[model samples]
Target: MTTDHPRTPGPRPTGATIVWAERVTKTFTTPDGRELPVLDDIGFHLAEGEIVALLGKSGSGKSTLLRCIAGLIAPSSGTVAYRGEPLTGANPGVSMVFQSFALLPWLTVQQNVELGLHAQGVGEQERRERALKAIDLIGLDGFESAYPKELSGGMRQRVGFARALVVEPDALLMDEPFSALDVLTAENLRNELVGLWEGHEAPVKSILIVTHNIEEAVLLADRILVLAANPGRIQAELRVDLPRPRNRQDPHFESIVDTVYGILTGREDAAVAAVEPTTTGGAERPAPTPTSAPLPEVSVGGLAGLLEILVARGGEDGLAEIADELNFEIDDLLPLVDAAELLDLARTEGPRIRVTDAGREFAAADILTSKQLFAHHAASRAPLVRAIVQALAATDGHTLREGLFLDLLRRGFSAEDARRQLDIAIDWGRYAELFDYDSGDGELTLDPGAQDAL
Candidate 1:
């Protein structure tokens, strides 16, 4: 974060449990009346004054778990306790910060900070004092009267922190609060927060943050809880025992980052849980096809771009080094890597991703040739794409109603997810020239000889 204030560890934790979750499970009913499990039998605890980070991919239910702990949502089953008391509703002692700076344009910095105090039925005079105190505490003293519109993104987020602190909360919950800011700004804010926590200037005693950034978790939290997707489960708990004011280049810091990377990319159980079993002649298939899932929202051009980077790096380690070099999270990088693997352009195992022979051929080709190769692999390798083409080919008119794909998708996906998968298919199909979709009548036509778009 910032260097104006030196870093130090916060007050020593008292070993008293502040928040607890026991066998928590969250399930949602899809629009089609099917149950979709987002979280399954998760359990965790936060000690007094301890900072815990929930790290996972986008759909891993990390945010949902945070919401449950914050009492913003009721878990389908299980118990959440704060200070040995069951948290039934919005806990009065908790404050929350979010990725989006949810500030009112009409409110000035002071007024916005005072909003929470006002809701608590606090007196106007006291609200003014606490709001100003928090504003000054969070390094926003000089901008008391500035409207949200007058402040930059970083400044707006400072106001959010001030507002959350004005209540003198016992615990703070942050959901990707730093994600929207630029790199330098986010680092500065993180350091400043560490400063506050160490100095015991902030009112909150404990924090639980949701983030996908691996290094950020190591830098801020004492413990990191990695969640797995497809009915999210707690896959691993890592203790970041490194000293504070952590050096980004230190070997220990690098080691911890690497450890988390291994857990995230190499957890075989997580991979197993995400697959579906299909029977062929009464025997279940061991490996599920990647194409059965939604296609990644990456273009062939994007895949080529990443391949160029791996080639430049001489087939480097997949997650940590590349992500650090590019200032990207595993969440942002994995989709492209996964897409490449599914298309036989690259192979990733553990934390390393290497370009395959097919990948090198595609990389060496001109744009037109690349698309042709991409078209061939997409039609042959991707199960969903292959199924669509075969369906269209088998049809009398070499066409089918587009909704048929959506219906097939719904059996395995939520409505929102089904829609996303369909959109991805449409885009990839158009790029590969595998099919022509007519928006006017919602039809997909097989176009085997579709000309080169490049």
Candidate 2:
């Protein structure tokens, strides 16, 4: 049995705090005048000699919080302190490595690496020496004169690492630094970085990384902070006590990975139900309102494919095995997992997903029967789909402009997110034959039998 490493909050590392954030909340005004909270009451501290990973799904504002720590952007509330000093501008003690390999095409690797020191007005001789040292340290010794355009994606990202490390700041903040590279290349770089950190070669005092990949966090971080989405909050914090050069096949490693999966999927508590109970009491929660439960941005085909795979695997399988088989980071599978659970097609037991009887039937049925089953579940279980069906049912002539739903969604979601939700809903509705949407006219017309779904 795997030991339970549930979120144990507090400062576990012995080193003094190098970067501290307290109750940092960030909210942005949408184009439509709606207040969209990105981070909610987030608090964490990075101590000297530790690497911490901010892990979460998309929209969890992991990147936003990282930027707040780097002082690239100020939080709407709360405070960020570097070594007991409040930051009023760009953090002097932090250097950032971006996902996009933000290197100027016109500059060579050495020049790009020297940009930080140049901005700080370092003398040319010292800057050159430091830039060369950083370039060699990051395994880019011979490529100092190569432009970004002339290097492979991994090489450019190495340049990014060199540039960030060149400053030798107190904290190195990385935003999905390996996300853009190919798998093998990324693994090579990741292994090298682990080597550097474990060997005490990297100059940064503390490291903070923002990532959506659970395995990466497990493989790299001493502490992992899992953030929740839709007004991001620190849902959980876990410390990994495993030894260096962690082995993936080790039982303890697998156990910790499963524990994180359970946390991410909320399976440690209960299988996802259509309505979650409130903390006030055992009061039955209301059916999700129009914008309360955002639909997982997955297609009907993808959902059906996942169910079929689950059925083929004797009706269940570990989330980690499935992700590995498909060459997907665990995060890539979350939306489909969520969709399956939302529609009652599958349920999660810890980290394993078991197909329900309904899921088996849907996977085995013919197209028409599958559509019927999907329509039934989507209308009764999926909040957004149910709302769309209900709205069309009440409208005159069984039709309404899509803008009406978009306007309502905007109250809760950002403009881009509102559009994404509508698009996903439209796709699901059309696939289930519950409704037809004309993009040209921006109108949705309910099918004759769609009302029966309600």
Candidate 3:
């Protein structure tokens, strides 16, 4: 799509700041007694008439920061203010639209939209009128009596929008609102939303959305706040200077995407130092060594598929080029690269992801040979995989007690995190054929055939 009208910053607000977060820090104490820092010294301000997007990788605490601003959760230290007033609890003028439909399946669209009003003791007649107005405004006029299950995903999210808007909030907070929809539907919704804001039809004075999709951020927000992981903080900010109804194919838009990707991946050529490498903040490190933390939950299939693509493309491609080719954002691409590097199957430097000799060999090998090569490298190169194998060996490949591993994991990570990492390890182990897990009995045992092969 294209537009001739020049796009600048949003319309100026009449007065007062809508929301402000100052030196906000949040830390969670895990069941394992580990202090997990989610957000650290993060601060930002949202003005009336501004649409700001908080863009970051998962685990970067974007959602946490959003909740902090909404007063759904309090910061461990620091303060959140709504309109210069210390926000201690949810604001009556603020409303939220969740990513999930969060609709009552049994309730009709009109009832769903009227829920908040009903809670505030609005009369049924007034609530019905307001809900109908919102539904009509959002183009859901006829669907007021439809159930959630009968509505399409886009329609369901439109209902979410109507429900949030029915109360006429001063600010609308959306958490990845369109992520659940298909591409065309999402684009359509984005346009409708921006049109609402531009036409001065939306009830809210400002919008703050938390989203991980880079293109979506650039397309929608007046300003994009980029957050970094490992004690999430505001890493950088980029103001979108393009015209509304942006052309995705525009060189400038692609440049911004590349710049953001560079920023997130630590590529030296990236718009910043080559953007700082995605780090866990230990000793200003370089590459995954043997002692690093557990690998992310990238599938063996994903790693192998990327390696095969690189091999077919002559063993290497520029990181940004690969990202474009694979249609993956930096957050999604990094985990696959990290997983491959963890297995010594791929190496990345500067802006290039290079397939290693092992990667090429694996690409050419039969499935059986591929499995053997993967088993060897995974055992040697990945810390978690090695730990699982060693633990099994030390126990003589006999009975398995997950309690032992779970305890070890919990000592350093949160209960939820430990479980997620263990799940990733299980998938890796099974793919490498290094171990067998019986789901029925909850037993993890060394694969006797794999042991004999080794």
Candidate 4:
């Protein structure tokens, strides 16, 4: 989308101040002539060398705001400026990393990383050097020749990061970049990223990340901008005063998480209860105020029951597979499977599925029944585990396992904890092998044994 806004001629180059969004508002006119306002009176500034996180629930216009700043979509009633000049369409100095990774499956890792540079018309040798540097920087040293399908979830994200970085963008915009990975791998990458950012001689001038995860906001953001919807607007701005390399267990960190949660849930409740009643016959009947109810308790027993059904069907299951086996429809099967998966009663591998060790224990009555045992486990432990799995999955042939670890840290993890967990998962869990970690350089990776737990 090209903009008619004239470029300001000056001796100054772009990237001097980074980004400025002033009173930006975006509205979309639907095909049926309905008008939808996505952002309202939004404003923010990203100074050079700063990382600001945009935090909100889905539909809160965080992504919309990011796109507006990127010049992917124009705002209806406000101006966005980069280094004092009004932004037009896609600026050469700005780049975005999407949540989905969006790597081309047909392309090799090197080719994918070099795409932006190629578009910018860089020479072949320069492109190769830059791409390799980005690859190495992201810890994908050897897998340049490997295809997307050969890499894992976390590794693919690195490729996405590399692609953006290779172009030497002055500002980076990420929309939930770590949301897709398992928890462990996400933490590893988060830590690694912190180190990389800290050690950089010339940093990406500014970063804007959009995320739903409250912990992520606290961990990675210098300032967290909380957005509200129903005509999206900035609700709150939180300065993360915690020191760099934040601790999740810290009281300050937990307080911020709680505050954000309260803001989201409280707003939802108020919105629901504020609906007005229809008048009839010149008399008013007050609308019923909706009451908030706590979520229903889920149990290991329930998870085991669902797992039994899945196992009975030989584990080759999709929503349809479970539905047909149990004589349930797609909707009916969702809650059961979701609850079971939440409790770790089952592990899904693409279309095929199986009961995890925890699930098996529950099914055999070796584990005690409890309300929301699975939910608690997932909240406390699953994030890290899933991250590791995703990192391993995303490696392609280029990135070593250690690079995956660093990437997770960079995404936002306690550095010491991230390293320790990787070691424990490898040594005790027998999940994978850790090749090496050099203080001067970064991590290295090696192959793991069969039957190693993930």
For each candidate in the order shown, give its overall lDDT on alpha carbons.
0.81, 0.87, 0.80, 0.64
TM-score of model 4 (CA atoms): 0.57
lDDT winner between candidates 2 and 4: 2
Q: Which has the greatest TM-score?
A: 2
lDDT tens digits, residue span 1-454, model 2: 0112243333324588888999999999877777888899988899998989998887789999999998989999999999999999999999999999999999999999999999999999999999998888887878888899999999999999989988888889999999999989988888888777766677787889999888899999998888878888877777788876889888988877877777777653521221244354667778776566789989999999999999899999988889989988777999999999999999988778999999999999999999999999999999888998998898889889999999888887788889999999999999999999998999999998997887
Candidate 4's C-alpha runs over 4 A off are: 1-16, 267-454
Candidate 1, residue 282: the lDDT equals 56
Question: In candidate 3, what are the lDDT values of residues 1-454, reduced to their tens digit?
Answer: 1223344535545456888899999998876576778899998998887889998876689999999988899999999988789887886568999999799999999999999899899998999999988888888878888999999999999999999988888889999999888878988999989877776678788899999888888888888888877568988788777777788779888777767765565453453432344645457666542223566678888888889889988999976677778776555687888778777788876557899998899878989899888888877777777777877877854558766677777654567767787778888789888888877877788876554433
Report the alpha-carbon TM-score of model 2 versus the true structure.
0.93
lDDT top scorer = 2
Return the lDDT, model 1, position 2.
21
- For each predicted model, how many residue pairs clash, with residues at least 3 apart or on different chains? 3, 0, 7, 44
Q: How big is the positional error of residue 66 in model 3, measured in Å on the Cα after superposition?
A: 1.6
Q: List where candidate 1 sits over 4 angstroms from the true fold.
A: 1-11, 266-286, 289-292, 315-331, 366-369, 411-414, 449-454
Please give the distance, in angstroms, between residue 237's alpha carbon in candidate 4 and its true position after superposition. Answer: 0.6
TM-score of each: 0.87, 0.93, 0.83, 0.57
Off by over 4 Å in 3: 1-15, 29-35, 121-125, 266-292, 318-334, 347-352, 392-400, 411-414, 438-454
State the lDDT of candidate 1 residue by residue for 1-454, as single tens digits: 2224444545566578888999999998877677778899999998876889999876689999999998999899999998899988987778899899899999789999999899999999999998888888888888999999999999999999999988988888999999999989999999989888887666788889999988899999998898977678988887778767788789888777766766666445433333333332756655444323457777767888888888787865556677768877665787898788888888876667889988888888897788789888887777777778778888898899988988777665667777787777777888878898898998999886632221
lDDT of 4 at 55: 81
Using TM-score, rank the candidates from best to worst.
2, 1, 3, 4
